[model samples]
Target: MGQFIISVGREYGSGGHYIASILAERFNVPMYDRNMLDQLAERNGIDAENLYKHEEMKRQGLHRTVRGHSSSVQDSIAQLQFNFIREKAESGESFVVVGRCAENVLRDNPALISIFVRGEEDAKVERISRLYKLNRIEAKAKMFRHDKKRKAYHNYYSKMKWGDSRGYDFCVNSSLMGVEATAEALYSMLSTYLKSKEQ
Candidate 1:
């Protein structure tokens, strides 16, 4: 059997992590998320907390010096994490990687399947609110801010937009389909894709 990879890009409250975890369980594969950051930090000789601090959110435009300093550190950490992703993918372990620009990092690998997960705004807001124990308005605002940061981070390092459908082999709407249904559909899709490639 050949190795497979799934990359999930999702909105802040879209339950992307949950869906990815489900798929990983069903497929009997490892899953990487923030834990990968800790591993990367250890390998790269950087502080894990500092790396996490720069993982999301963009620097404010004010204060040129501050922006430059933060960007440099963030870029270095991103590059190191990218290297770690490459190493993992090459290690013959089939897995699902959540965020950290894994799709962009593994774009050229023939053995990987890239997926993007998104949902309707209302569903996303409700999910975020319930999950984070925030009011609906606060959840909406937080979601917007998180998406903005994700867009900026992705655009800064990749040629493609973060959630753009064209960049992925599969684009799933978890709002309409739900997590279990989405995972089933993705499993079927992966089976077909792998079959076609083998022929």
Candidate 2:
């Protein structure tokens, strides 16, 4: 299998995580998602759960931006996490990294292939409601709120605008293609892409 670095940026309920899992299985590469937080916390002496909580708090405007925070704890995690992601690439390992601004972290690496996954609002809300057992209204709110948080996080952390199709090598709309189809398409495309690069 070709060694390729794939980073996926996605909106909530877009099946981004599922797509990444499929890719990792197909590529036989390590895939990282929330586990990156576990690694960051373990390495830096922070509680693992708090990493997610802190991010949520910041997203809700309960805390200032990482750079503006008085103690800058958020900033520290960002740096450590960025380093963690980079180190994985530096390890000469093929990987599918999802979220956490991984696209920005590895943007300069020639091996990097960034993908963005998006879906229609109704489709996303439907999936969120079904999977999470939330009511229609609750699911809608949760869905939109998540998008807002993601945009805030990406805008603050990366050069590319969150969910901008132009920034990624591939953009998939699961609303049209479905999760499995999107994953299959990505695998086929990435295989061809890696092969072309080797020629």
Candidate 3:
């Protein structure tokens, strides 16, 4: 089997993480998301809590976070994550990585597949509300805030714009087909993508 690195970019509450998990199972490959931070902390001797506090969402705007931390912290963490991503890709294993601009890190890999997953506004709001146990209004506000942060972080780190269809090889409206079906769709498309590479 060919080694493929699948990078998933997504909107808040789009079920991107779940879909990536399913794909990992289908491919029998490891998946990384929040766990990336844990791995980084363990390997680099950084504090896990600090990494969590500054993860993709909060790293973009230093002034907006707690006082005394500068953009330097964000830069170091981002660079570490990118280095880890490249290390994983260099190992030449098939893996599904969610967010943290994995696509940007692995763009030069021949077997890389970048996907952006999104959902309808109302559906995403409902999904987030249920998952986080928040009311619909609160869910919408939370989702909006997260989307803004993610977009800012992604754009700040990568040459491509976040959520831009042109930036990815494929895009999925996960809500339209649901998580399982969306996973199947990605699997099928990835099969074709791999075969085309061989030809």
Residues 34-125, model 2: lDDT tens digits: 88888778877878978876552223324555555445566656666778889989988889988878888899898899999999988998
Candidate number that wins on TM-score, 1 or 2 = 2
Model 3 regions lying over 4 Å from their true place:
57-71
Cand. 2 TM to true fold: 0.90
Kindly give the stretch of ten consecutive residues in candidate 3 with the minimal lDDT sum.
57-66
For each candidate in the order shown, give its overall lDDT on alpha carbons: 0.82, 0.84, 0.87
Q: Mind giving the per-residue lDDT tens digits that candidate 1 earns over 82-164? A: 78789999998889998878888999987878888899999999988988999999999999999888888887777788898
lDDT tens digits, residue span 1-199, model 3: 7788899999999999888898889889999888989998998887899988878853544343336334567766877788888988898878999999998888888878999999999889989999999999999999999999899899988999999998999988988988778889888888877888878
What TM-score would each prediction reach against the true structure?
0.88, 0.90, 0.90
Candidate 1: segments with Cα more than 4 A from true spot: 57-71
Cα lDDT for residue 89, candidate 1: 91
Clashing pairs in 2: none
Give the range where candidate 1 is weakest over 10 consecutive residues by summed lDDT: 56-65
lDDT of 3 at 66: 39
RMSD of each candidate relative to the true structure? 3.2, 2.7, 3.8
